[model samples]
Target chain A: MGRTEIIEKVNTVFRDVFDDDRLLIGEQTTAADVDGWDSLKHISLIEAVEEAFDMRFTMLEINGMKNVGEMITIIEQRVV
Target chain B: MNYTELEKNCTRSTEGFVDSCTLAVLGTGATQHLAKAVKGYAYSEGIALDVYDADYNQIDAQVLDPNSELCHKSPEFTLFWLCTEKLYEEFCQSKQRSDFADTVIQRVERYWNLVNGKFRTNILQCNFLQLDDRVFGNYGNKTADSFIFQLRKLNCLLMEKCLAHRNVFLIDFCYLQEKYGIDALRDSRMYYVAKLPICTRMLPEAAKQVVDVIKAVRGKIKKCVILDLDNTLWGGVIGDDGIENIQIGELGIGHAFTEFQMWLKELGKRGILLAVCSKNEEAAAREPFEKHPEMVLRMEDFAMFVANWEDKASNINYIQRTLNIGMDSMVFLDDNPFERSLVKSMIPEITVPDLPQDPSQYLEYIKGLNLFETASYSEADRERTRQYQEEAGRAAQQCQFSDYGEYLKSLEMTAKTEAFDSFHFSRIAQLTQRSNQFNLRTVRYTEQEIAQLAGDERHLTRYFTLSDKFGDYGLISVAVLDKQEDKTLFISEWLMSCRVLKRGMEEFIMDELIRTARDNGFDTVVGEYLPTAKNKMVADLYSRMGMQPAGGGRFTVQVKDYAMHQTYIRRQ
Candidate 1:
């Protein structure tokens, strides 16, 4: 998948896990940009994203990622 | 349902539910996800569950304290999710390790006593999932000091402990581990990051296990399984294959069908009524059960059998009416997808499981559904199929007489009514939970509560058993009269099995109730009817039995003014 495609799929995961239909995310978006993106929901978000992309995240990557751009980069590396 | 759907259901509104229950969840680890999953699953089951999730790792503090939040909520059920990972950690730290199972059971007993002493809530304890540390390789099975050995022993000890406590029940988490495997149910990374013990993918199933026990305890259970013939019970079409060539024995691909029949026969022995609904001739259907030496299910095993060319939906409806059980309480299994879909679409309440295309996977698939979870069982359950067969006999004999009263009298019916004793506690409690249609007031009690009522001087409890020339309906009805102020006896509960309906059992019970009231020096007998979606059959029962209405569904009749009901049942 391309960067834009990964971002679009990740956006859908965010929308679903946050229970928001109108949620939109960009490469520069961080946890603070999304409502209800606390530590508990972050786990659910990681699980949903892994399922959506058919990939598992490393423990360090899951904890250290700060922005949606980094997540998209990780997905871009894994998918290729 | 998947984990995402269950999490989404957590936010769904439960405002319109007429049936609701309160549950308090406490765990040695984090239980936020499990509690959410339980609430979501209960919503899917159409039960409004108000779940109180305790703070993480607070099972001891919350249970030991008398004035804690758990006590304030006073939930109907208190679930203790004791995780094996936490238990392993305790084992690593403990100096004395050989008796780990016994020590852990002692702690569990303390928690049970503390909670039971404070409230009347039912305790649900999750058993340990047998996770092997592999320190001793395969020698763990023989070594008592091994973690795997202790875990297995702990599960068995928990079952024995629960047997002694009437209010305690096990969740069978170890069985789930065996089904899904450890890798699917556990995530070490998630456990380290979050205190959650069960993986997110497995939460819905774990929640379902909890909800199944709760549903069974609340009297929602499946009583009968309606089966389809052709490839469902055997290998080929009996009508076309001519029975002798049809495969059901030790031949190739026939072992699966034989094993399937064996499982169904065991279910029949467990008191689940089995009926045949096939689309073949009656002789073709009855031939294999009668003459085949390899067949596990005989003619006597089935309570009812119907074989014809009629549509399966109509046939299942007829079976439901004849069995007198709710459509929701019946599971119809057919190997044909067309029939399964048709039955599902026609009767929305009935449970129709889609059989796999392969016959070999039939028993394995049904075993995972856990469709027959029950809360209580007694020796009376073994006689259930015979009772239903006798009911069929009575039904067939009813057409012989034009007068219903004369038919009842000619049956030579006799009833034995006695006060609640230790021998009938399990069956009495089971009746109180299972009887819904003919139940007035619909008050459910557990065995512990029934024993308490039997011992209390303010209450008089009676359980009635009915029999005829055909067979016996063991512990068919129950009535509890509470002594009130002003020399009045209040009928707190009156419920009877639908199998014995229209057999003069109601009149017989009422006669006994009035007689007991008069003999106890109570001048008035009061009865009440609390209406539910299912109990409408007994709405006017009190009035029909000569009790005058006193408003608010309460009926009263003076002991002196009460006339003896003429029933065919002679008291034993």
Candidate 2:
């Protein structure tokens, strides 16, 4: 999967986790961009992405990503 | 199912909402996720649950403050999920463990009294979760004075206190911990970082349980379990494998089927109507139940049994018609995926749970679904199955009669009507909450409110229980006549169980009401027919029962001209 494909898939997850279908996730989309994306639900979003991608995110990878674009790049490398 | 799915679903806006309810959550720790999950799950269940989440660890301020959001919300259901850290703090401050337990109980009592006095919502108090004790370790249970022991005692005491209050309900989180495991339910990292005691992963599961309570309180509970015979009940097809060959005994693989049957039997005892819908020769399908010595359920246990080569969905339709219950109140269980899917597609309202491939997991899966969550249990509930079975017999006998009037008269039905007493209070309140179709006015009330009405001299509260030659229909009807107006008796609430419909019981109760009005020297007895989506069947009850339409869904009968419109029911 390329970064675009990963971003496409991850956007669905973002929309689903945040419960907003119209949510458009791009390079600049951060936790602050979405409603109900608090620290408590951050872990659940990561877990859902892991389940969707059929891979596990390291604690470092989970904590290190600052934006949706960085998360997509990490998932791109993992999927490949 | 999981927290993410629940959260996502909660965010989606719902249309065509039915049975809207308000719920407030006051937690000692983080509970916003739980509130979201609850809204999502409740929406999926067709309940538009508006949840109010209080500030973390500020239950006292939220519950006690009159100007707080909780006061403004005044939700119909209030859930309190408190962790043991605060209790532990109290324990450490106290000199003795017993003193700690006593003080905790006192605090809960004070808070509950304060909350109940201020608001009218039902309080769902969760028991303390045993988050491991290192003080006494394994010996904590052996010592009554230990923290763990005291906590257990405190939970029991909380249950006792909750039972004493009609509005307070203790939700057993300890049982949830046992089912899902303590570690899975509680996340230490989330607790430290976000103050979330219950893990985000298990928030959906917890919220599902809370919604179950809300569903029961709102009287949206499943009443029947429609089972599929053959592999669903036993290990194999009874026709292919003979009664003796079917796995349903104490030996090896049979134990799982036997345990499942035992659980179904227990459910039947608790008043959940059991029926069988299978595709086979009726005689062949029933032979195992008739002849098998190891069978835990007998033919008498089932209220309706349909066995034929017809499609299972059609048979379920037939069963629903015979039982006179809504499709939503029935749960169909079948081992075959095709049969389950067919029923699901045809009768979407009926609950058709996905049966696991393994038969042993059936018991745990059903228990986890909480399919039959009941708000109140009484002696009447225990007699529910027997009454339905008798109803089936009556239905069978009705087919032989030429006319419905002759059939009702032949049954020798009689009813004993009395004021709402302690014995019938819970059942009356439950019936008022749950009864929809035949309810003239669909007004729901709690047990405490019913008790007050029963005691008030101005209100003439009557609960009717019918018994024919077949059996007793335990506490089937309730009528509250308010005499607050001058020389007028107002029928504030009147509802009856759908099981006892079309039996002349309505006429019999009307006669009793007329007699009461004459005895009390009232000039006019007023009644109403409140129209709701579910209660359209009884929209014209007042007009049909010979009452003049006084406008605004109201009707009145003059006491001097009140003719006893009776057919069969003999009052006792």
On DockQ, the leading prediction is 1
- Computed on alpha carbons, the lDDT of every model, listed in order, comes to 0.91, 0.84
For residues B436-498, write the lDDT of model 2, one tens digit per residue. Answer: 888887888888778889899989999898889998887888999999566899998888888
Query: Which segments of model 2 are wrong by more than 4 Å?
Result: A1-15, A19-80, B396-407
User: In candidate 1, what are the lDDT values of residues A1-80, reduced to their tens digit?
Assistant: 89998899998988888889999999999989988888777877888898888988888888899999999999999996
Residue A39, candidate 1: Cα error in Å is: 1.8
Against the native complex, each candidate's DockQ, computed on alpha carbons, is 0.63, 0.41
How do the predictions measure up, each by TM-score?
A: 0.98, 0.92
Q: Residues A1-80, candidate 2, lDDT per residue (tens digit)? A: 87888888988988777777898889888888887787767977876787789886665666678998788777777787
What does the TM-score come to for chain B in model 2?
0.95
> In lDDT terms, which candidate is top?
1
In model 2, which residue pairs have backbone atoms overlapping below 3 Å? none
Reference-based lDDT, residue B411, model 2: 97
lDDT of 1 by residue, B1-572 (tens): 86778888889998889879999999988888899889999999999999999998898788888899998898999999988888999999988778999999999989999999998988999998788999999999999989998988988999999988888989988888999899989887788888778878798999999999999999999999999988999989999998787889888898999999999999999889999999999988999999999998999999999999999999999999998988989999999999999999999999999889999999999998889999899998888899999988988999999999999998999999999999999999999988889999999998888988999999999999998999888889999999999999999999999998888899889989999998889999999999998999999999999999999999999999988888889999
